[model samples]
Target: MSYDELKSVLVSLGIPEDDISPEASREEVGLDSIAVVELALVLRREKGVDVTEEEIGGTLTVADVAALVGARTPA
Candidate 1:
């Protein structure tokens, strides 16, 4: 999952596309606790990425989340 892909997922989750950037914080992009969980489920179920909410929740910025997903994503 690249940064753009993760940003698209965030957009689908109702986050404003303009609010998302590589340096943007998760909270700044409206990624609350519930959103974190939903993102995890969406990634796993829809994108077939095996990421957990805890992992996503631990991230600080959008880049961090993208890196986590990219790391877990198979090439």
Candidate 2:
């Protein structure tokens, strides 16, 4: 998964670009628990990545999400 694609997913989930940075946590970005769950679903349904809810909850930042998805994505 490309960074842009991940970023787009974040935007679609209601996170603003200004709030999401490589080092910024989801808490810092104002993405609540509900939004994080929805984001996991989006990544699964749209990007074909199978990310668990636990993993989503454990994610620290936008960059972390991207890395997680990227790792699962087929080359």
Candidate 3:
């Protein structure tokens, strides 16, 4: 998925655009547990990627999420 699509998840959650970036950590961008769930749900429904809470919990940055989702794509 594109970085814009990933950023949209944060935008949909009302997070400030300036605070989001591919390199920004989830905590640095104010992504609480609820936001994480919302992100996971969005990725699953909109991007067709199955992400676990534990996976999201362990993420250190937005790029990490992108990589996680990208890596899960079936070949």
Prediction-by-prediction clash tally: 0, 0, 0
Highest-lDDT candidate: 1
Q: What digit string (tens of lDDT, one per residue) describes model 1 on residues 14-72?
A: 99999999999999999999999999999999998999999999999999999999999
Off by over 4 Å in 3: 73-75
User: What does candidate 3's lDDT look like per residue over 1-75, in tens digits?
Assistant: 667767777788889999998889989888889888887887778778778777988989988877886786444
Position 5, candidate 3: lDDT: 68
> Which digits, one per residue and each the tens of the lDDT, describe model 2 over residues 1-75?
887888888888778888878788879877678887888888888888888778877888878877888898766
Selected candidate, larger lDDT, 1 vs 3:
1
Report how far residue 4 has shifted in candidate 1, in Å. Answer: 0.6
> Pairing residues by index, what is the TM-score of model 1?
0.96
All candidates' TM-scores?
0.96, 0.88, 0.81
Better of 1 and 2 by lDDT: 1
RMSD of each candidate relative to the true structure: 0.6, 1.2, 1.9
Clashes of 3: 0
Candidate 2, pairs of clashing residues = none
Candidate 2 residue spans exceeding 4 A from truth: none
